[model samples]
Target: DAGITQSPRHKVTETGTPVTLRCHQTENHRYMYWYRQDPGHGLRLIHYSYGVKDTDKGEVSDGYSVSRSKTEDFLLTLESATSSQTSVYFCAISLRVFDTEAFFGQGTRLTVV
Candidate 1:
């Protein structure tokens, strides 16, 4: 949590509005990820970046988009937020060459009304 930084750690917004969340890392890792936590689904990946300017969508990429313009920064955007989009968003970073565990940020709790 200390290594990774998330801006606007908590947020409240109206439906149909656009919102953006930021994640900053100091580890200089090559991989960064964005995820959302919900009750039944556990933790679902929203998007990820392998390197600067290289990003990919994850399983739950429908309403979310991501960008990584710098090695230590990743951003997740909600184009048009809805009530159903309210959830806790987390950012993770990993330096592993293969399959391994990743470090995560504290998380950003977002609520839409």
Candidate 2:
């Protein structure tokens, strides 16, 4: 286990609303990532922060954003929720090699109506 947790294990929201998901870690890992897992598309990265104040967009970052001002916390926000964004979200942390296996939080199931 990588000592990671995600809040609101499940969420339901209307379209056009704003939502934020939180990721917390206890190991003080240097890398944290937010990814969305869809049925056929697999797990796609939304954003990642390598360190405090050091963040970058990932492959599927268009409708999402992230921030990390501390080593143990990373936040993901959906500016405006959309039905297209309904998916299971997962947070991961990396502490070993670059391709090191990541540990995932239980996941947050988001549904936008």
Question: How does model 1 score by TM-score?
Answer: 0.94
Per-residue alpha-carbon lDDT of candidate 1 for residues 1-113, written as tens digits (9 for 90 to 100): 54899988999999999999999999899999999999999999999999999999889999998899999999999999999999999999999637977999999999999
Measured over all alpha carbons after superposition, the RMSD of each candidate to the real structure, in angstroms, is 1.2, 1.0
- lDDT tens digits, residues 1-113, model 2? 77999998999999999999999999878889999999899999999988999999999999898889899999999999999999999999988536778888999999999
> What TM-score, over all chains together, does every model reach?
0.94, 0.95
The C-alpha lDDT values of all candidates are: 0.93, 0.93
